[model samples]
Target chain A: MQDKPFMSSLTTDEVATSLRRKGRWGLGEVLFWLAAAATLFFLPERHLILNEIAIIGLFAVSLDLILGYAGIVSLGHAAFFGVGAYVAGIFAKEMTGDPLTGLAVAGVAAALLGFATSFLVLRGADLTRLMVTLGVALVAGEIANQASWLTGGADGLQGIMMGPLLGMFEFDIFGTTAYAYSLVVLFVLFVVARRIVHSPFGLSLRSIRDNSLRARAVGIPVNRRLVAIYTISAAYAGIAGGLLAQTTQFVSLDVLAFHRSADVLLVLVIGGVGYLYGGLIGAVIFKVLQDILSSMTPQYWQFWIGLILVVLVLAGRERLTERARFLAGRLFGRSAGAPRTAPAREGRP
Target chain B: MTPALETIGLQKRFGGLTATDNVSFRLEKGARHALIGPNGAGKTTFINLLTGVIPPTSGRILLEGADITRLCPELRVQRGLARTFQINQLFPAMTPLETLGLAVSERKGSGRDWWRVFGSDREIVDEVVGIAQRFRLADVLDERTSNLPYGKQRLLEIAVAFACEPRVLLLDEPAAGVPEAERHELLATVAALPRDVSVLLIEHDMDLVFSFAERISVLVNGGLFTEGTVDEIAADPRVRAVYLGESVDE
Candidate 1:
């Protein structure tokens, strides 16, 4: 055997530079955010729906942090969302009505809940996680329902008056202010979430999601990472909920409903998962489709949405996304490169 | 001096079957040891017990004289006990760069940092690059682990464990299913591990066992059958009788 030490031709600096470059923002990302900003001036009449889209998109992004990146399947994500809405609502009504303050208060409240409940998820498989998460949302909804004095119960928390943004821009009925506020909040939080997923902490979560046993073997405290991410995701969801309550100036029990969780999950299914853009793109597609379809057939819009989901699943989300990327690359004069799919998991020997 | 890893009267019973039967074993510091056994001889189970993958039915395990029988698997790894799976257990979606980065970052106590970019930490990146070069995985560092060849994946499996900088390494069939052309590289890397890290190789390949292990322990029916130096085991008739089913001369 050769006794000479093995040497790699690549320098550490070169590799580090390349990795750093990968995390840099591309033109597409810049254009995507610019287009979102442009909606304020270009589509004045659509501000209300656009505001809703921004809030939902933020919620979806929060879910992606745990579901897409960490491989945590949470059906009770709305638990945090509802907590944020109620906390913001009560904060505005009882404490302070400052929108940013309400958001912070709601985020912290949801984070505490997330930290408390994250332990339940550490013990189970996917199915168990789903059940536990679902139970958490259901239980949260019930608490909100039973505490009529605090939450206004089934009637929902009303008469919440949010102060102007930064004590300057008053919230207008046309939703121009709300859209701008929601958009800015979404962008800031998305930037933070973007940083998180590309961090070492984020990489460990992906490892746990892919194969937790090997993750543990590599000396990663799997449960702790899960707890931390779950808590962060909850805070994100809470912030999204706070946006919804602040924008509309109302809090509803529907925020904690099961359909909210199911809907956000469906949004991820539409956009793709793992990558951060999936949530944002999926939100736009989902909300727009709902708007267009519901206008055509209000009652059967759900049926059409369900059909689309079935089609997306049957045709394979990855293949469809690859095709879309290929088309986009051709249109934009860039090489899409070879389409890649994750290799099928190998069974144990 | 204390043994690197020790198991005292370790036993595991699965219903009516005793998989690991009262096996008390010790691997001295910096020992190059191999555990050999027949099919279903409880080789993997013993490693699992030592790594704390599964709790023992009774008895204790120690790492460098520290009682670690009740330690969780990740905790054992934190305490400097690292292991590879019998099957290739790896994150299929992550590239080798990301995989090694995770290990190195975790070891350096920076795995929980969410604010900084992953490769922004120059120290961790340098170590990851060094380890990747040492394992000959620098070329495929950007390739997804599942996309790499079986041989390279196997190397990565060991590379990740090595990244932990463990005091004692347990390699479970590291060469299993590797092709003839790739087997030599795998075994060479295993043989070339740092001397300060005590290694316990669990393998069915006798050639690898003989070439790499200075000391050999034979396991039969979940119990320690015999243990001796390479020459002693090579000349033992009872070991042959158990392995080859040959009649023993009285």
Candidate 2:
């Protein structure tokens, strides 16, 4: 062991360096958000595709809260998504034409559903959670299919008539307004989720995920935290669904489909599950790939997508990124910028 | 006036076998006690029953005179009862700094505050740094728990339990896998614990038990065979015949 006096004196400075903000917004995070905003200015014509990416990004983020942070494997997250879409659709047609009010209604409805059904997740392991979650989405899809009088069944909800966002911006033909709207919603919610995952509550979730038994032994209320995160994630997914419905002025039974749940899970995994930006990056990649491949092949795009996913999985996220950086550095004759997220190496900034 | 922890006729059975057969135990405030027995003598089971990890078949566990027989593990933790595992149960992915920060924050009742930024809690941060220093973990604070040496991991484990600031701490084999060279450091840290927090250590190491425990309880076949001071336990021929002799043979 080293000298006790030197080690004792070194404690405060060393601890501060190590324990300080593990996830504060960096320059890269700021630049990324700014670039996302800049897209509205430059890519006005591609707003429709951008809007889709934004919605999926939000959905992936919602899944990340439970799957990545809290270590809950859910396969029926679309239950809340579908519920939100239907709730928003019904609110617009029957109760209110105001978009914000409808979105709020959708969010609350989905959150209530999440809270009510969260207990099932509390008692089970990964596979059991997956089954229960899948069961919920299945039942929800069945209800939507059978209730023709209320939901329009197979044809989907029609004549949504979403009043202008905040009584100002109309749902336009070019999708500029829709694009901006979803972007803003995604940005705000991302900020909130980002803050949450960096907070003390977020630390507890990580601890619970890493070791539930030890978490409880250390005075953390594991089940309560799980239920809370699950309900919050449901609300987030609900909001994403509401954004989709309002932007498109439509709600299809497909929103509640099992594929929606599985697709979102795939997007999250592609991006990097635990990190917030993983979902965002994953969504953009997934949507852009789907667009290009679907257009080129029109029919066999699934094969291309599956191939890409397999390659990505086989290579692994960190290794692939490192390889990409290494190749870029070698080609450009410039060293890669300090391997992002190596804060300890960089020392106090 | 009340014992820090007391178990009344605690019993546990797994259908055909009674693992802990109506074993009653007690520890006074600030007591340094040890529970020693042969392998599979149900020492872990007894600790589990006491900590509410598993409910006893029938018994009452009183903590500072309040009955906590049916209270959950977390509730027991809140009531100032904490324990370290025989095998360290730490979050493998997290650094010691993160782990200790969490333990400190949770102990101060801020574990559930999702809105508050973790690093901004200066008081909790300071407390965690203090704990890290106390356990000599400041050097490896940034290292992952799983990547740490066995001795450091054991120290971190005890530090985690200590972060809870429990009234009574149950250390289950704190020095089990630590190398001989590091055993002195572990023992010194254990010996330097605050006087207010009563300790009940479960160990197979007689050197540790004999030196540290003021009162020793020798358990045989899930029952308390004897309880006495260090010298008395060493001299007791019945305890020696059943446990100490067998321990030497093994």
Candidate 3:
């Protein structure tokens, strides 16, 4: 206890030491990110594969917010993603052609819905929460199908023309804008999410996830925070969906399918939840694998995915999780030279 | 000042079983009171009711002269009511300093910042340090609450709760798992509480109870069995025969 005066008295080293105690992502993250950025730039665009990867990456990262940081497990997050895409699509058809407005409208709409139904998530266990979310997405998807006038129903919306970026920056033929647009979108959201995870609100979510009862007893208002985070995460998903509709002028009913959401979950899990950047990396890795497996043997793609899933589960989620976290840290490690989170507990920093 | 809290006919039932059968008591501001009884005395249930966990079947809970029986837990907390568990309630992965910062933030209404680094809140940092120091948790501020010794965990739990600066605190068996050597520290902390802050402690350790409490209440089964000073309780023949589980003549 005596060390506190000296510890608290010296503000500089405390925060620095605190950050150091949190451990630095260091050189690994920089190299991985730079290399990743270089690869994306150098690699020739082929069949919109790179574009698809960006969309899925963003989707997976959105799921990571709820799954990893908030300890929420959802298999139906794609519902929000799909909803955003549809909103964006409809906006492009009727409203001004600027994609960002559509993105904003879609995000706000999805976030509002996420906030409304979040209470359903706050009370239930992980599995129960997943079911409720999945059901919500399923119902929303059905409604979209039934509302043929607005959503284009089962036929899906076609000829979505996002006039341009801000009605000026025309999308290039090489998809350089699409890739850069998606990349920039992903980068900004990731940073915001990072700030969130490191913020007090973010700490509360982790607290709720780790021990809801304790958090409540300490007056954290657990349920409210849960709902808020869910809403915010859904907003992220909405933005990701918007990015998709923007890059591709058409959006199909398949975007709203349950499989899309399930795939997003797989990305986070494969990457590792809770560890920031795990979902992003997981998205890239999962997309690549999906691409490779589908190309090698299109018919048996599921079989390869299933086999890999088994290995991932057997080798242990913890192992892959650590690897994911390590990779994520390397790619997005920014904790270096930053102030610490909180003073250590017992011996934990 | 008025009593920190008061409960009237706090009747609570789970199905056919009455968990708290017509219990009522008043905790004056600054009073160090102890509720002592044998096991299954409904002590925890009473705390739960006060904390808005389970609604009392037919009762009213008032805090600082305000009717708070219908208030939710968080709302009640906002109105300056706080409590701790019989078992240690802690965010295991977090350090004590982090834990207290959160507790202080919850009190200060800054717990909503989802992007602000908690350590960046200088006031909260100072307050956390202050609370942790008072509870003797400053030494282990960086350690995980779960990894600390059982006694230290209890101390940290109390410290964290204190970060809220609640007007009243309900401690459920603070000395339950703590070692004999460190029980005094726990008792001393409870004894040293501010005179204006009320504390209602539940414990089975009669010696510790007798020392820390200026007033005492005995709970038998699910009802208030008796209420009196420590001397009155120690002198009561029925208390010895019933709750002490010993011959009154002894």
Candidate 4:
């Protein structure tokens, strides 16, 4: 018991974080998080926008775990999200309508699916992983299309009667229950992920990304760690999907579409990599830009989104967070020391 | 007594070339053995065979007298056998302390958990710090490993390996890319490791080879050409001609 680190837990890193709060999640990140959270509360009758941002943020953050932390660049991440959504819908329809249970089912089901396909991902490069994962999602969409009685197919499963959450909090027609419910889930997962990222295991994943052969020689088992993280990321993605389904009380083939995965990636890149708050910032930017652009001209809305994405790419998405950190240091009057997280995959090796 | 690490009839072939041919070697419980050879010699291939990186064509590897020819690299590490590489394998994105922490965790046999930040045992953390400090990596504990000086990277790699607390440490050219000035410090660190921890150093630097090793094994072509004490190998006329430079091949 004394030898086991997880068991004998007199935490020093917590103390480190407290004593030196000048690390990577510096003042700038703190402000960005506050501003993002404040948007939900302050927005005037923009609940729909808020809801979309929250869901997409969770999805993107989940993707970022594998992408940024683990170096698994998956292009078909939407499959897990779609699977979660379908699982939630199925659970609500057949079993208990408990949002918690539905979310769990969605996550578990997606995790299982992810686990099964993880082997395919293990062998290939990012391009292969992308094509295979997206292929799975495309196939799944087709399956849902065929299983109209089960999944409601292309038209989507409808006539869902979602009972009160926890049998106490009733859902409103304004989508207040769904929005509030999803937001809480997102917050808890975010905090949990934050803790994970800062942990020793997380540090190893960064190492694996740095140089895998070197990691192996140092006695770090590269493949096993990658698989374990892949499964966990899948579970997170699955839960994200479930949350969407449970909130909307609907599941559709579109949930499994390639666009969803691509969009989640866009959100992650836009917000920032490595920083957990990046998801929220990226999601808000995407959703708001989407809204403002679409309203300007209902036709060719995607054209505007594509143009913004191009601009973001040209501006260097990573620079946004860097500039913010510089600004935060200036404004907060705290000397932000060097970033705690070393850049992932940075050295030309 | 069975050797701490022994390879019997170990053979490795790459396509038409036999890189390692029936190489047999033994390291006692505390043997500071040096495996040395000239360029094109199968010294690295032999190390790989012993470590199970490349499966032998027909041979058996016994760790602490137990057969481990079929075991994978991680499994061997778990069996108290660890190695450093010919090339420094430090994680570029990680500082020495963090890299040490990961090595410590792997040795503890814990699968990675993402949510497990800030609760590692104090003893383990202390041990990690001790290893880093000893390697002179305390200053670069938070700096990215790539940013460290070239010599420091070598030290950091050794520190990461040290965290494993292995019974048999296979160091593949520990001083390969090190500056002459820092080579002594590197040698001193290797010399100071626990007596019970046996070392197999594959070094081309004879100064380091002679300084740290008690007994030396020489590899030539693709086989064990000679095995003897430093004085004997240096004195052997045959070894001098083919390897020890005591005699000219001409």
Candidate 5:
């Protein structure tokens, strides 16, 4: 047996290098984004579906920020999404129609609501959080339904006219511009979220998630961190909702519906949680499955989706991913070996 | 100088049972103190009250002469009070590196910086590495914490608390479940803790308590039974009857 050193002799630079390497963007990440961008030219005819996927993907990512990292179970996430949708729609109709400005306004509005409701989440366990979140969404939907003059009530907010993307690209009927706009917004926010989860702040959040008692023992202000992440997640969801409003040129009561919250949770489950990319990956699979199944059986498409969910849950995500990695490693050989272990251990950053 | 940690007339009652009964305790600055009592003697309860895990029924806790009875647990930690639990309260999913990083970063007030990557700060990395080495966890720093040996996990429990840079450290039975071979490392590390940091050790191991503590406080039935030096406690027959007599038989 080799003798162990009394102290680590590793230089600061070496330690820093190893630490930075953990957060480095891997080739898989680059390839994933490249494929997303390639959809613009390769899948132009499917831009409408692509636009929807981008918006929902962003929404799923927002939920992942709170549920995945902070372990805050929010069932009323759609409350923020709905708020963003209405705020952007109104801002475009009554204020300036600039898509970027509308998105900003909507995000701020959702963040405010998130900040206010964040305290409610701090007081409860998982069950309480779920109830509170669900309650918030229900209340939001009812307000949108009753406030007919302002929100168009159950009729839905209509005639939302959005200005060009960056004062240039118009939102066309084919959704080419809308897809591009949503994709960019998703990418930017994804980068920010990525940065957060990789940071010390993010590390503290994971600690809080794993064991709040120890987190507090170590001086992590658990409640404050939860509130911060919830607010930021609210902003992300709001932006995603704003994207939907801008791209579709309409806001509906369904945006704040309970189904929206459940659907986002389903998306996270499909993609896996804690890791950021699960939402994006889950969104792609969910939206595509919805599109294909809906075409085949428009009335009973949800039955097939539910079936898939059951299979996915019963089979277990970790086992399935391991199997996928084994197959990919066999196909690609040595190149996939290192990357597999990296993500398997840490879950992808 | 004020006591590093002081509990004035601390009392805790769980319904009809009095867990801790009106006890005033002080851990002097830079002192090596041991708090020993048999199981159910309310040693853990006293530590819990000091750390603000559960509020005392009626009492005032002071850290460095400032009243901290109403302060929350994390606030106490922030005020340079740190502790290890009787049962390890570690993040099972995190590695030792990440655990130390969290502790150190939080101490340096960078735990809230969401925009900056955790290891991007050179100082934090250096300190984490330093703490890992000091605690003999350098080799297994990257390994998941749950998979670590019972001894290393205990070391990590101390290492994380040490990383908080606390003025007073409460170690609750650090050697409880450690096997014989690993006890040396655990004890040596405990002995080698910085002198400037006051240590209050709570242990059932008479050997560790006797060797490590300059001053000892004994508790019985949730109240202070006796206080003395090592030799004085060793000679006290009442202490032996209430506590050490059972340990000697074991």
Candidate 6:
């Protein structure tokens, strides 16, 4: 046995050193939150677009929690999204119109489904997990279609009336209230997620993702952690779906559609993975690009979107960010170390 | 008295081949034991069975008198069984600091706390730093494990096992690929391990096995051929026959 360490294992100096190295709120984080808040004042005309971005951003964040952090590839995240939408829609119409209660109900319903299905994911590799998840979404979509009375079948669930958020600020025609409400929900959940991803549990998830056998050898409960994170991510997706149902007062079969799941995956890849802001940034770019391309070409918009995804994939997210930084330097005449504030993506390729 | 670890009637048959055939062994508390065999003698297979990597065909594994034959690998580790891989299995992307910190945190049951920031956990950070220093990994603690030198990577592998505060440590080829210059340091570290933790070292190097292990077990054809102290094994005619190119029949 080697001699004990010099510090006598007392933990005084080491603790001090650790505390000193502790990461606090960096300038980039502050700036990112500030910009998100500033959107309310600067983008009044695009409230609907911003509201859509917030909802999709939440969905992408949920995917990142499982896919990027936990290394669980899910192809049918829309299952939870659709579950939340239908549950919230049904709850508001049949029971209470209170938005928060509806959101809670939606999250719980989706989380239960996620917890039940998590066992399937725990047994397989990436491809198997993908197929299982996609199958789940397909099954869920069928259920929604077949159960016409509760889910309104193919036409979708309509006549959802959400009471004012906090019983004060009513949802509006221009989506102003919806934007603020969604942004607040997004911000609160983002904080919770940010806290989670930086904590010891978050670090353990990354370790498991990197090497699960070693993780198991080291006494990390690999299966339990995966199941926990998967369930939480499902709840997050459910909340995003609930936001959509509440904001629009309409729930459709598209809530559980394959396109919804596929779109979120595309958004995450475009923005980047493992990083919290990847989903938010990806949703913004995905929605904005969709908006512009659909208006311009209408029929061929998907082609343009596909082209952008291919370009992003080929260039690599890190390389594109580097090139963007270089171009920005050339354009703005700013030096390399000019306190550049990017959201916390960590930029690992 | 109960041995620290014991395997009773342990047998593993892969199809028709008996990789380990009814091999029973005992390791006393604080005993420095070595399991050495020629190529294909199932040294690694035995270690795998002990560490819960693979289930034995028919046997019982007892840790301090409690049967742990059916426990999962992680549960085994939690029960104080730790092993370093024959091949380096450190996480490639994580720095030594992060890897060690994670292991320590898990040991302390803070592994699932999503609210506590890792850097702020002084006790864990301190323990990790101390382990890194003891393993001579202080300078490269911040460097990725994959980028570290091979010898250093081997040391880090041991360091990670130590982070678990294990009662039984299975060291498989601790100095297999280490360079000649670093071999002394590696052996010295192994030699100096605290006596409270019993060590079962699986090594092919005769010099290391003779010097480090208080008792040695020789395995031939997936079965225990002989067992004795360093001197007794050295002088035994049967042991000599196995090593000196003489068949047991002869």
- What are the lDDT scores of the predictions, listed in order? 0.88, 0.87, 0.77, 0.76, 0.90, 0.86
Better of 3 and 4 by TM-score: 4
- lDDT tens digits, residue span B51-163, model 3: 99889999889999999999888788788888888888888888886788778878888889866665677777767766765787767877877789989999887877777
Model 4: docking quality category: acceptable
How many backbone clashes can be found in candidate 6?
Answer: 3
Among these predicted structures, which one has the highest lDDT?
Answer: 5
DockQ, all models = 0.61, 0.54, 0.44, 0.48, 0.61, 0.52
Best by TM-score: 5
Candidate 3 docks at the CAPRI level of acceptable
lDDT of 4 by residue, B181-213 (tens): 887778777777778889998887777888889
- Cα error of candidate 4 at position A194, Å: 1.7
Candidate 6 runs further than 4 Å off: A1-23, A323-349, B240-250
- Interface RMSD for candidates 1 onward, in order: 3.1, 4.6, 5.0, 7.6, 4.7, 4.1
| Model 1's TM-score against the true structure | 0.95
Docking class for model 1 is medium
* TM-scores, all models, native as reference: 0.95, 0.95, 0.90, 0.91, 0.96, 0.93
Shift of residue A28 alpha carbon in model 6, Å = 1.1
Q: What proportion of the real contacts between chains A and B does each prediction keep?
A: 0.79, 0.63, 0.49, 0.48, 0.81, 0.62
Better of 3 and 6 by lDDT: 6
**Model 4 residue pairs with clashes:** A84-A242, A85-A241, A196-B114, A196-B115, A199-B117, B240-B246, B240-B247, B241-B247
- The TM-score obtained by model 6 is 0.93
Q: What is candidate 1's CA lDDT for residue A8?
A: 76
Question: Cα RMSDs of all predictions?
Answer: 3.2, 3.6, 4.3, 4.6, 2.8, 3.5
* Per-candidate chain B TM: 0.96, 0.97, 0.94, 0.93, 0.98, 0.95
Off by over 4 Å in 1: A1-4, A7-9, A335-349, B244-250
- Model 5: CA > 4 A from native: A1-11, A333-349
Rank ordering of all candidates by lDDT, starting from the highest: 5, 1, 2, 6, 3, 4
Candidate 2 local lDDT, residue B239: 88
